[model samples]
Target: MRKHLSRVLLVLTIGMCCSISCKKDTLNINYGAITEDLSAYLYAYTSGMISKASPIQIRFAQSVVEEAKIGSVATNVIRFSPSINGEAVWEDTQTLRFNPSDYLKSKTTYIGTLNLAENFFQYP
Candidate 1:
């Protein structure tokens, strides 16, 4: 009986020691508040036909609001510049759309920058 009790106690002690010594790694991901500047791209499209005098339409994906003083605000700020020697063209505007009559170019690349801001709960 003594030996049996001793063996049971020893096994229990070993199990307790192993359980206490065991360690596990945990990963914590925080979806905290993030703030940064972002830019987007806009492309001009035309039919299958190619010509130097062909009209191009400027199109952008979607605009997001990064910051607003009052209600929700969504707009695009863009600028336009001419492209030469296969170089990229620059376009800037706070509005979303522009007309071909506003600028004249052929076989050019246009650049666009999109600024988005939103408000979320910030823990104190």
Candidate 2:
């Protein structure tokens, strides 16, 4: 009878130890936050066809100084492969908007590039 009690106590102790050591927890994921250690495109953005009359926007990781020369500098920043006629403006300190004069031509793919090597593109 004592041996059976000892065996039962041993099993109960082992079960208690296992339960205490192992814990069930939940993980949270942030969509806006960067997750990859090293990525080709670090910042997540949507590509391909954009809707009509919808302004194209560029978002920077950090805020920039929008100085007096920003108007001229913004124009030269974004360039399209097929060439697009648009007015570039600053939506905010970190966001730049390219508003096309009219709706973009259908079935046409526009390749845009951001030339951020200028002096006005400095981060503070």
Candidate 3:
């Protein structure tokens, strides 16, 4: 009787696993698009001190706008620019890169902003 019970449980578990894994993959295809009026926000890395010469790369949880739009908006808020103009590079679909014209000051805490609002940094 014990052996029969174990066999029944095994069969039930196998059936459950098969059913769960049989679902389709809908990522980036037929997952259905969602539209909203959300705006882009800033995200900063604060694990350690950022290098003075390192180019600031901005990433987003979701696609907000084109690379040019991020650069244009960032330029108006980011006040750490050595020059008025810096190169904005988009490396991936959700990442925007900016090479500062000057090195960041050492031991000085810098805050990032989005549309003149603060509290945009997060750790994940």
Q: Judging by TM-score against the true structure, name the best candidate.
A: 2
TM-score of each: 0.22, 0.56, 0.40
Regions of model 3 farther than 4 Å from truth: 1-47, 67-77, 80-89, 116-124
lDDT of 3 by residue, 1-124 (tens): 3443333223222221111112242112121111221122212222223455666554544554554444343434333322324555545545556665665555433333222232122211
1-124, model 1: which lDDT tens digit per residue? Answer: 3443333223222221101111242223221111111112222222222233333323322222223322322233222333212211223221233333433333333332222221111101
Off by over 4 Å in 1: 1-76, 81-95, 116-124
What are the clashing pairs of model 3? none
In model 3, the Cα lDDT at residue 56 comes to 59
RMSD of 1: 27.9
lDDT of 3: 0.36
lDDT of 2 by residue, 1-124 (tens): 3443333223222221110112243223222332332121223232434465567665554465555434443657666656778887876666667877887765444555555444333355
Candidates' C-alpha lDDT: 0.26, 0.47, 0.36
Q: Ten residues in a row with the worst lDDT in model 3?
A: 14-23
Candidate 3 all-Cα RMSD: 21.6
